[model samples]
Target: MTLETSVGNTQSFGLSSKYVEKWEKRSSIRTRPEKKIDFELDGFFFPEDKQPVLLDGRLKDISIENKSELLIRSLFKYLNDIVTLEIKLINSACNKIIYNDLPVAYPEQIKMNAYTVIIDEYYHVYVARDLINQLKARYPYLTEDALPDSDSFCAVNEIMKRLDAEHHDLFEIIAVCIFETTLVKELVEFFKSESVHPSIKNYVNDHMNDESRHYIYFLELLQYTWDRLPDKARRDIGSNIADFVKMYLNIESEKEFNLNYLDSIIADHEENKQTVNAIYKGFEVTPDVPIVKNVISALKRTGLLDDENVKSGFTNIGWII
Candidate 1:
C-alpha cells in the first residue's frame, strides 16, 4: 500500500499521530541496548569557553531613539533571513533524502518523515509570509530587499547541499540535529526575554511559542531515529553529534554582528565608556560571563550544544577545556 494509504487507514487520527504510532511500534520490538535507550539532555556538558556575554546594565538603560529603532528593525531583517534559511535548508534536505528513498518503512525513515511534517506545518509559507509582512509594517525601517531569496539565504543551504553530495554519514545528521534543534530552542528563549525590544519581543514571543512545539517534535523524532540505529551506527552517530556540537559552540562564540536593538543599545551606551567597553569585550570573549555561560549551558542542556562529544573533541583539538 502507498504510505499515504497506510497512514489514512490508521486508527489514530492527528497530524502527529501517524508518526507517533510508527515510533511506538518500532520501539516496542527493539531489543538492542542502544535501540532501547531514551535520550535525555540532563547532565549534558557545555564548554567553559563558549558562554554568552552578560551586559553590565539592563536593556532598558539603553536609550531608544528613532534612529535606534530603525537600526533595530534592520537587524530583524537579517535575523529573519537566518530563520528562513534554516527552515528551508532542513526542509529541503529532509525532502531530498526521503524522496530519493521512498517506501520509508524503517524507524529512522519515520522520524525523518515526522520532521518533514513538522517543518511543513511550522513553516507554512503563507503563515510565515503574513508574519513577515506584519513585522515589516510594525517596523517601518525594515527594507523589503533585506528578505532572503531562495538563492541568498544563510549558509545552511550550502551545508545541506554539500551533505547531500557527500552522502553524509549518521554523525553528520547528528551535527545537523544539534544545530537546528538547539538554535530553534535557544532563539525562542532569547526572544521571550524581557531584555529584548518591545516590538522584537512580541515577534520573538510568537515565534517562540510555535518553536516550542516544533522543538518537542524534533527531539522526539531524533530520539526515535537514534534508538533504531545499530550498535556501530549508534556509536558513530554519538561521536558525530559530539563533533558537530563542538563546531557549533566554536562558531556561536565568534558571532559578533550586532542585532538592530543590540546595536542601538551599544550606541546608547557608547557615552558610558565602561559599558561600551564591556559590550565590546563581551563580543570578543568566548562564552565569557555568567549570562553568556548560562545561555550556552541552557542550549547544551536543551540538546543544542554538543556537551560530552564536543568537550572531548575540543580537548583533542588542543582547545582549552
Candidate 2:
C-alpha cells in the first residue's frame, strides 16, 4: 500500500482529490440498486464454515432442525455485531476526526474523506439492520436479543487503562486505524462463499466496497499521525500496540460468547448441551492469523514496526513469531 509519512511541502495526504472523487461512483449509498433484493429462505443465512458450531463434529449429531435454527440465529448475531462495531467503535472514531476532537491535526482532505466514511459506515449499519428485520419477518420464531458488547467493543476500556487521559484519543485513533486496516479481509470469505444466499453476498460486497477504501485511509492517517509525534510519544504508543492488539483479539471472550450462544440455542436439550460443552473444552485455541498478519502488515506499511519497542512488543506477545 502506498502511504504518506511526512507532509513536507505537499498539501494533500494520501486521500487526494482523485480518490475522494471515486467515492461518489463507488460507494454503496450512491451506487446501490434501487430495486429491493429478494432472499432465498431455503438457502443458508450464513456460511457454515464461518459458524463454528456448525463445523463441530459433535454438533452434526444434533437434529437438522436444531442446526437450521442455529444458522438463522447466527445471522442475527452477526448483524447485531456489525451494528455494534459500526455505531459504537467505527463511528465514534470518525466523529473524533470530523469534529476536531483529536489531539493531532489532519489535512482538510483527510477530514473530508472521514465525512464520507462516516456516511458509508452509517449506511452499512442501515443495510445490516435492514437485513435483520427482513430475516426476522421470515422467522418470527427465532428471536435474537441484543448481544452484550463484544470483546472488540469493550477492548477500548482495557486498552485505555494503560494510557494517560491525554493520550486517550490518540490511542483510540491508532486502535481504530489497526481495526480498519485489517477488517476487509475478514469480510471477503462471506462475499465469496457460494453456500450463502445471494443477498448475503451482496451485503458483504457492499461492506467490502467501503472497507477497501477505509483501510487505505486509515493507513495514511496512521503514517501521517506517526510522522507528527515526538520520539518519546512514538515510543509510548509503539510499546503499547501489542496490548491493544491482544485485547482487540480477545479469543477467550469470543469463545465464551459463542458457547453461551450455543447453550441458548440448545437450552432444553440437556444431552446435546452437555455434549457441546465437552466438545468445546477440546476445541483448538487459535488466533485469526490472517487478521493479525494484516495488523502486522499495516505496521510495516506505515513503518511503525521499525521502532524496536514496537517490534519487541509484538514479538513478546508472540504475534510476530
Candidate 3:
C-alpha cells in the first residue's frame, strides 16, 4: 500500500502513477463484475449502540420493543444519503476536479490515479443504488425524503455552500475526501461489527475494498496541495478548512431530525413521549464516537491538524479531544 506521511509517498509506485495500474490488476472487486451483490436486509441496520436511541422494550409491547423492524426501516432511509450522496460527491463534483483540474495542476503525479478514482467511485455509487432499489422494493417507506439531514447529505451540502463558486469543485473534493477518510475508519468497525446486517456488511466490505486504496490518495492529494501552495494561499485555505470542518460535520441537526423522526412514527401517541425522548438523546454526537474519531484521525494523518489555526478551530468546536 502507498501512503504519504507529509514527507512524501512511502513508496515510489504511488508518485510514479504505477500504483493505479497495480491496484487495478490486483483488485477482485474491480475486476469481478459477476460477483453477486446481496440485497437482503438482516432485519437490523446499525449496531444498537450506534442507533439514535434505544428503549428497554421489556416495559412495552414485545412487538413494539423489538425495534428490529423500525431500525431496519430507518437504515433503508439512511442509505438514501449514504449511497446517493456519496455518488453525488464523487460523480457530481470530486471526480470532475480530479479528471479536469488536478491533472492540469499536478500533471506529473495525477495522470492515471485520478481517473482510476473516478472509475472506482462510480462503481461504488452503482452498488449503493442497486441495494437501495432492492430495499425500496422490499419496504415501501424507503422514500428519498424519508430521512432528512443524513450525515453525508448534511456534510456535503454544508461544504459546497460554504466555498467560493469558482473553487466549489475543489472544495467539494476536500469535503468528500474528508468523509472518505472517516468512512475508511468507520468501515473498519463495520467489518468487525457482528451486529450489522449480513447483506449490508458484505456491501460495506466491498466498498471498503475499494476505499482502502483511495483514502491515501486523497490524504496525499492534500499534502500535494499544501506543498505546492504559497504561504498566504496555504494559510487562507487552512483557516477556511477549519471552519468548514466544524460547520460541515455538525451533528445537532441530525439529533433534531432523529427526535422528530420519532414523532412521525409515534403519530400522536402521547403516552410514548418519554420513550421517544430517550431515543432522541441517543443521537447526540460526541467527539469520541467511532465516526468522529475517524475524522480526527484522518485530519491528523493529513498533517492538516498540525496547522495551529486548524487545530484551534477543531478544538473550539469540541471536535478533537
Candidate 4:
C-alpha cells in the first residue's frame, strides 16, 4: 500500500477491496517505544553544530555551543507546541467524522476507520504530553508555559467562515487531511537526522509508522467525501484546500505563540531578535522542503489537485512548480 500523490492515481487504479484489507491489518500504536530520553547528550533536542535546524536555515553561523543548546531547547519547545496543536486538531477532526454524518461513500467502513484514527490520534496526544513532561522533569530548562496557539487555525477559519454554515465542517476535515498529509512528509528529515536525539527519533518513528496508515486513511476518506460533494461545494472547498497547504507551509511563526516560546529560549528580547535573524537569515520555502512537496503530492494523489480551481490556486500560491 504505497501511496504516491499524483492526480488520477486513485481512480486510475481504484481503491479496490485490497486497500480496505490493508487498513484492517494496520499495526497498533501500542508498539511505540517507551524508552526514556537521555538528557546527557547536547544534540538530543538541538544540534551541536547549529546547521539550520529543521526548516529554519538561519542558524548556520551562530555556532557557539551555548547558543546551539539554547536553539535546541527552543526547537524542543517548538516541537511540544506543534504536537499539542496536532492533538487538538486531530481530536476535533475525529469527532466531526465519527459523530457527524459527512457524505462519505462508505458509512460503516468509514466510521470504523474513523474510530481507529481517533484512537491513534488520542494516543499520539498522550505520547506528546508524556514526552514534554519527561523533558521538563529531566531538563527543568524546557518550558511548559508555551500555549499551543496556532496561526494556521486562524487562517483555516478565515476561509471556512466564508462558506455557509453547512459546509464549515468540510473545511475542518480538509484541514486535518492536509495536516496529516504534510506532517508525515515534514518528519522524514527529522526521523532520518543522525544529529537528533535518539529518543526524539524513536518518538518520530512511532508517529511515522502510525501516520503512514493515517495518510492512506485520510486520502481514501478525502476521495470518498469528494465523490459525494456537490459541484459548487467541490470547487469552493477544493480551492480552500490549496489555501491550507500554503498556510501551513509558510514556516514562519506568528508573534503569538511560537515566537513567544522562541523569546523565552533566548532569555532576552535583544538576544531573541538576534537569534530570530540568525535562524531565518536565508529563509525561503523552496521545493526542497519536504512539507511543501509532499503536501502537493498528497493533494495530487487525492485527486483534489486535478480540480481546476485547486490546481490553479496552488499554482497562484507557488506551492507547486
Considering every candidate listed, which one attains the maximal TM-score?
2
- The lDDT of each candidate is 0.41, 0.72, 0.60, 0.63
In the range 1-321, model 2's lDDT, one tens digit per residue, is 343453234444346665588887898889886323375445576777776656556576877667667767777777888898888888888788778555577667777888888898999898888888887887887565535567777777777787777777777777788888877877886546676767777777778988888877788788777776666666777788887777776555445556676666556556555655665565531245667777777787777877888888877777643
TM per candidate comes to 0.50, 0.85, 0.78, 0.77
Off by over 4 Å in 2: 1-13, 34-41, 55-58, 141-146, 265-288, 319-321
- Considering every candidate listed, which one attains the maximal lDDT? 2
- Better structure of 1 and 2 per lDDT: 2
Q: Report each candidate's C-alpha RMSD, comma-separated, in the order given.
A: 12.6, 3.9, 4.3, 4.9
lDDT of 1 by residue, 1-321 (tens): 122221113332222455545434432112111111111212111111122222444544534343345334444454555455455545554544354442223334444654544454344443445555665666565665533343233233333343333334333333344444555545655444433445444444445544444454554444434444555554433444323333444323122323323454456534444443455553422345333353344344444334454455445544353
Off by over 4 Å in 4: 1-28, 40-42, 47-72, 103-106, 254-289, 315-321
In terms of lDDT, model 1 sits at 0.41
Better of 2 and 4 by lDDT: 2
Q: How far off is residue 92 in model 3, in Å?
A: 3.8
Question: In order, how many clashes per candidate?
Answer: 4, 0, 0, 4
- State which candidate, 1 or 3, has the greater lDDT: 3
- What is the full ranking by TM-score, best candidate first? 2, 3, 4, 1
